[model samples]
Target: MFGSDDFKDQAVWEFSFRIDDGGFSWDYKFKPPLWKSVVGRTLSKNNDVLLLDASHDEPTDGREETSAVFQSRFLEGIGPIKGVIYGYHQGPEVLKATGNQTQLKNWLRDQTGVRVYRDNVRVFNYGEPSDDWLGLNVRRINRPGDRFGTNSLVAAISLDLESSYLLKEKTNREGFDGGGAFPRFVKLVLSAFERFEHVAIDDRKALDDVIRGKGTAVAPVRFLDAMDSLKAGVKSKNIPKAFQREIDAIEREYTELRDVMVSAGTAGLNLAVIFHEIEREVDALAAAVERKLDEQSIKKQIEQIHYMLHGFAPLLRKNPAKSIFCSEVIEQATRVRKSRFAFHSVVFSAPVLTKEEPDFKIKAAPNLLVGAIGNLLDNAMYWTKVRQELDASNGSRAIRVFDSAQGR
Candidate 1:
């Protein structure tokens, strides 16, 4: 009942049927035209065939209607079977219909209930094996020095029989018991199947060992492990946004510090000229204060001025690195900005180094460390001024600096 519209012109097939012993035999005559189509010309002899037992469970008490869809007709004493032959012409049209190898494989598995591996099939030219085997799971056996050219193509014969009484039926069959013709045919097919199964098992084992990094196969198991981790949702933290913010902050701080250093350099040069010209004047002013002023406050002011000038000198000088107490660094930075604190009326607090507390010391260039702290204080004072102008009632224009001891 094969028709061109049923399977398209790309379908080529053959089939056979037989009644009880010599009763009636039916087979498709492979005419000259079909024979011409069968030989792949440049290929080897291609009449390889496989036999499959398509047995399934008998219908249960309540599932008879559902199971009936898979049932086949009876062939007299040979049990129930619905015979069919189907094939696709291995041409561009077939490839277009199948789409790709993956789709072709899926279609095969859906129709045949078998898993196909890439190496399951091979073709052969004169005597050498190739990988050009066409559709219908045509697996080729590698036989060196075969004179069949490229006529070799593997095919399977699937017999759909009821599973519940399949063994009993086989034993009862006339030609199947006691090593008859049927037994020989069955044994030959079984042997072929056994060989194929062994090959499949070995192939699977090699693949498994390679995947686990336990064999000679040089697969990238570590890379596969990483891919597995990613599939399981192991993700790294997304820190670019936070990192960019920190970078921007550092850049802004650096720009301010550079501007401050440039201004200090100009002030330093002016101070040097003033120091030379006012050196004698400053001394005379201090002596006059000690001699005639007689006020302790005036004397302390003169000494403070001398101290401040020396402190400013180090800002432009090359101060060597040494272990300076953290308390001293904080005090030096605060001391330089003490007047600005008063001028802005901003409340400031700093840790008072006491005998009970351990003052931390850091090895650094004191001038650079003090300059960094000074820049921080400048930022705090600027923000504090802004807050006051934004809302006077808030009245929170304050800056506090503190250090912690390990135990405290």
Candidate 2:
């Protein structure tokens, strides 16, 4: 009954059966198996297990399923037993049988998926290393990015024998008979895993990107492209129109989310640049003080630094949409670049704003705007230095920033 081909592998598996005692009922006065009750008591408090009762209304009127329509109705009414599923790695502490940290870690490393329990007794070979009851390992090997392997989870499905009569165990005591309710049980379990994988994969990818310093920019683009490919592949198959519509909706949502991430990432990168710029200025200020520069010179430098920091106040505000004078933003950015320009022997030319233009304000995140300008200055300084080296006559390279109306 437990042939390799008979039972296909999956991330989630179902073990449905009823207790021998007729008194057991999920609705009222339901006595859970020792293992199930223990698990509910122990793991439920820690939120390790996600309990779902898929119990449906029992057929009131007894009707013989003689016709195909009646058979379909009967099948629809049949629901799995009330069971709880526990996902490992969903929390900080991994599930373990022993209290020893080393032993628990070893168990997590060695164990393969969830174990099965029937009437407080563990069903052997179900979650054993050699057992691939749900084909979790197989699916993981095929699609590593989206599937969880054997070591990643632990779960148990318990059912009473009297309530789950349709799920019959094989004569060899290996597994359930692969007939009638068995296939439906497998389908129900797989459906839950399918929903879980959707969210899990995104979280996994996001973490990986952060660790590798790749940022969130690449994921959305790749996801959208993959969706397009999947949509095309699904179109070739004889799938329903609703499936296509759902896919289209998902694609649209991903696109919007990608845009938001891109905008946020850009702002973050800008802020990083501004932070470095500030650090450089602070270091220079510290150096002048240590060198025991003249009091007047030191005071002037301190005032300049103060002015630069004062200009950054708008950028540091909590409300990013606050407006600031465009001229002031430009002046602050140019001030940050002054030391670099002088060190590189670059002749820098900045625009002179008239009285009328001084009042011109732009709605932008102050730090991001300054960071963008700083990056432009960095590029200009680099290219100017290159030009200076290439031409002996050009001892100093020039950078000019002017408004178009000025024609300078």
Candidate 3:
């Protein structure tokens, strides 16, 4: 029927359909169903229009006179039309013979309540200069703009039934009528599908779009809107599921960061414990060194160790934040690595200050300031060593500390 021009306006020989996926299955009364290509395309484009038997003519040269003798007697005994009626006509009798097709379509829509397709209306001229023949191909039974599985199924069933009847040479004279029951049933099914789609399909799609980074431009505002809805106690079916998904994603990120922080803190604590044990042993050794001044080299090494211990001990202790001079931080940091300076022969310099001069003071945890200075010295020492290794006579390897004399 779909391939033959004769059956294009008539009916098919047979129609049948079956859908199955193990858990669900349905079968419709159709055999040798319309070609898969034609039916699949029609189902996929549920709302596309197909116009048949249309004509194109030149516009009138001038305004035509309105006829006053038109009568409604021809329509007196006509019943309501149930089938689609193409606005196309034969010969030269079309009202707007020279009018644009689009305008003509609009005029027909206005006069007859027919919905003209706004997309994909193809015109074929057959490569000749004769009057143009136009045709629109579409599924005519669907309600405009409504798309759902059940709606499509209903449409398919209607088409199959109509095709079956037409094949039997049935016409309106046979009094074949589909009552109000099927229409009411269609309304109920469409209503249920709409509600389910709003919550499950549409909202879930929104969540997927934002998660895949496809909707980044709208994500911030969408989140804000969700928050506003929550705060106002307005219940929205769409937001809750998407909001939960986003929350789970964010929580996973922060959980990873928290785990990392915990591991780092544990490692720091273990290092501090090792340092404390060394400090205890060194203290006992220092007492023994105090008893022997004859061993000057060993005694001096012990003193340097003591200085380093003093510089770092504050870091482990529970020291409250307080006002302290910046110079003290620099001094302690340098003191901790005092032996390195001599071993490397690196010159260290700082401004000489008297008790009369005010030094720069900062209110912070003393250990923080010491740690900051220690990092700077570490970086400086590394590059200074690199420079000396590159060229020994470049100059003396040195580190200098600067500060405003007025404590700015």
Candidate 4:
């Protein structure tokens, strides 16, 4: 049983950084990429240390120390950079109108990966800035308020999945405008769903023509064209099924296309789900440890996960130990000291907070209990959003929070 105490070991981290780059940068904190917060909670437990020895290992270590190798080696010949990089973007894949849609938006945000940024319409995964350019056109929106209004937040999103049409500009509030890379991806995905919708109607028309033993049904030409477009959407390799409603229409119309289309739709849903989890994992990880990961390595790991399952080997080369699952621990290390005179002994102990507790003090003052409540309220708010576990093996939410006066 790996308890919280098992986690604080210095072994939880690795040691290595570029000497040429001067001291340490963000990447230096995580000798093992997975040891970073992302894998900490969900995976940080020491399961036999299957990778490298914390005390003695180099970055370019051996196979026993790796878990995601083919990620780099296998992708050596995967593409026209544009096509390959773009493939996963849309196949990867949003919302809204008004009324309940807004309520749903809040619910959706709560449900989607905390990494996903949504406001009635768009969802963003623009944090931790990935280092690799896998066809993803990342844009940094630095405080929309300063450039637009005072109510602004700065964020960066990386786009690597491939797609055909993009929502780069705005449209008639119904379809899409297609301006930013994300919008274009959304619009094209929805458009593909539209194509799926029409195919059924077209199929009906064509069937009518054929079954009537004449040109009475719509026309096989029309239905066939629909099939072509549907396949094209599939072939794009983007997060398919972005446009779901259209396919649902098709499912109600033609049973054949519905079968294929539905399967694709499910895959799209799964893609969204996978991405959603990735977003949460990423957000939690990124938020927990800003400068711990090698941005390039994170990019590489994502790409590897995106492309080859075999690639997991090299990806884990540096973090095979942390790539498994998430766990929780409450560990505290303490010490006691006695004076030579022995009148009284002072116990100076650093109790590593586990089981998550508030570390701030509350004092009643004249006329400003309001301020005290405000501080307590603010501290509470921070704790709620954060998953604070102190074990280095456990990705810690915040370093440590200081509570109040102890009753002797």
Candidate 5:
């Protein structure tokens, strides 16, 4: 009775399930971590969803139980895959609908290697589209909005992916990277999204030059190979914790790379081509959106973006020294608010809190956030230039920052 897409979610669950009216549905967020062991074992434990008792093929059919997992068999068999796993919120009806939890468990073990029992955790759906996109990016694309303008609706969707899937695990355990499979799953989802769309793309070679924003999203490259070096050192000495983090990172990277390799089959590419295409498509869309965008309308968008960036700057300067690294937070933001604010022309603001320092340190993993913000700023600037034609006729127009605390 389940659709192909529904099966796809089941294919990926490393082990958790939801409790609902008739039965439970699998949690897609838990799958990617399972593969970490095959590639490079991670130190983090699996986010087990289902508890399984898998049986062997022998006549006696020896059995072993594993609650949280996606046996290889299941992954190969499951269906309706979307671009790597993004956040999935079960429709309330789906939760209430009857599902044979026992039958589902047997199907998983027989088809795939995963198994699940039950847990105290209640299913909580992150209902935002942006949250879904961010979850998609944890494994695919360097980060959200890296391929498009941050202020673009696409960016908002990408933000959701970040929050729902990646943020929590990272916050939960410093070493979950080994067990972290979300990023890898994201790669698979992105590949799947484009795979079915059949949109022939041609210009991704420019992504290299595209500083699409957010520090972590920018493909983290450390100055000193601290992680690698530590790994080697640990190999020589049995330092359990020291090498664990390294192992986790390596496992995550490997899983992500593997997913990308599989997905990139026909469309796989580096940055250059990707960026060029993204730009072209965006421009084409912008041109369509407006014939002659007056200076005020365009300026409002830029101003909003700009103020947002300025607000982030103070936060960047705060303690722990984490840069307001995201492109949006670091760069200026200028947006055209749907409705008029006190400043009807443009509304610019920072995405992060500035001025006052928080008790906890924030690592503004620069690339995704900063890059997205910058994209918006760049677009706003472009609109401003077009709007400036008024100055030649008679008067000079000025732009000012609204958030005084932002120091813009």
Candidate 6:
């Protein structure tokens, strides 16, 4: 059975051979079973196989072993098929010789996942890339661990149940029928995986430590220890204490410099936010100024422009301490309207404050205050042009501004 061409052609990394001949014939070379032949033909060159001989006859006492008992015995160490199972991992030398760890990993990933065979026939849908038959993917996704993923494993479990007559394949070939044996088979595989995961976790941690150079002469702890030793040797030799003192002073200066740089960075960030807010407000004002208005609406638009500018006062000066002359603020705000007023042949006027009604100063942010007033003037200019176009009598537009101490 072992000398067949099929077995010779396939690469078997691991194998378990067992026989329960019942002391019949040691010299007899029985032909490989149907399942073994199928496995030989279908197995990949990188596959593993499990061979069992449960050919022992039924008890003559009329009390046959139950399927559960048979399964238990098979899992235990008493079966004729009992043997040590071994797995292989490429050593560092082999990995270095390949010089393409990525390619090897990709290949292993492609070949990972478990395939099941019953009576020598491959089970469908279990080992496919898209099939998470064991809920391994789900478990990994929900509770991630440094354990095996589908692309990191390749396994197969072959079962021979002809004698027990407890399991049957489904008609669709997806897997075994939902009989008593199916759940037990699944449980057995999962239990084995739980143990495998524990080993894999340790292995992964060891590899990580190696990669990080931990527990080695080049490690951070060792490097610091070496520096301390050098410093002690220098002190023993009575090297210049002045040099060490200078080094300590320089270190202190560097720490203070670092703090200053951090503060500067934080202040720069705040400035950027303030600049962005100002730009957005300016853009909105510009858009309002460019809008078209109807011919007969002149006075109403002027009031709207005033109202809009008034709203901007609060944004300009968040606090009440910053103050500017009311006339000066209005003049700055109306500057945006100069070009528009010229193009439309409109006159812009800012009435001078008389002596009796003193030109009082108001608290406001200069930029925001200017922009708010400017937008109002822009709206007035647009509507004034429209009015002039409609009625030649309104040939030119006029914008007048007045400021009061009461804050209008």
Best candidate (score: TM-score): 2
Name the top lDDT candidate: 2
lDDT of each: 0.41, 0.51, 0.38, 0.26, 0.32, 0.46
Taking the tens digit of each residue's C-alpha lDDT, what string does model 1 give over 282-331? 66567877678767766665775666666555556556579999888887
Candidates sorted by TM-score, best first: 2, 6, 3, 1, 5, 4
Q: Mind giving the per-residue lDDT tens digits that candidate 3 earns over 1-408?
A: 122232212211111222111111122111112322212111122111111111111111111111111112211112111122211221122223323434443433333211111122211211122211111112121322222221112111112332222112114422222232222222222222232222233333433343345653553556546555554552444546666666666666765665455444433533433364346447656776677645765666577566766666765554457998877877766776665566456788666333344467889767656666665775676567555544545577898776765464
Q: Cα deviation in Å at residue 322, candidate 6?
A: 46
Which runs in model 5 stand beyond 4 Å of their true positions?
1-24, 27-408
How many clashing residue pairs are found in candidate 2? 11
TM-score of 3: 0.30
lDDT ranking, best first: 2, 6, 1, 3, 5, 4
TM-score each candidate.
0.28, 0.33, 0.30, 0.15, 0.20, 0.32
Badly placed stretches (over 4 Å) of model 6 are 1-97, 100-106, 141-146, 161-164, 216-408
RMSD to true structure for each model, in Å: 38.5, 28.1, 35.4, 29.3, 23.1, 30.3
Per-residue CA lDDT of model 4 for 1-408, tens digit only, reads: 233332222121221111111211111121111211122211122111111111111122122121211122211111111100000000000112112334433432332211221222333332223311112121112211111110111112222223212333233333233232332222222222222222223333332233345544333467656766776676686645755556556645785554445444333323322343345445645653576677776775455344432311221122112221111111100100011002112122223244244343323221122222223333332332222211223332222323343422
Candidate 1 residue runs with Cα over 4 Å from true position: 1-294, 352-358, 394-396, 404-408
State residue 247's C-alpha deviation in candidate 4, in Å. Answer: 79
> Between 1 and 6, whose lDDT is larger?
6
lDDT for position 382 in model 1 = 60
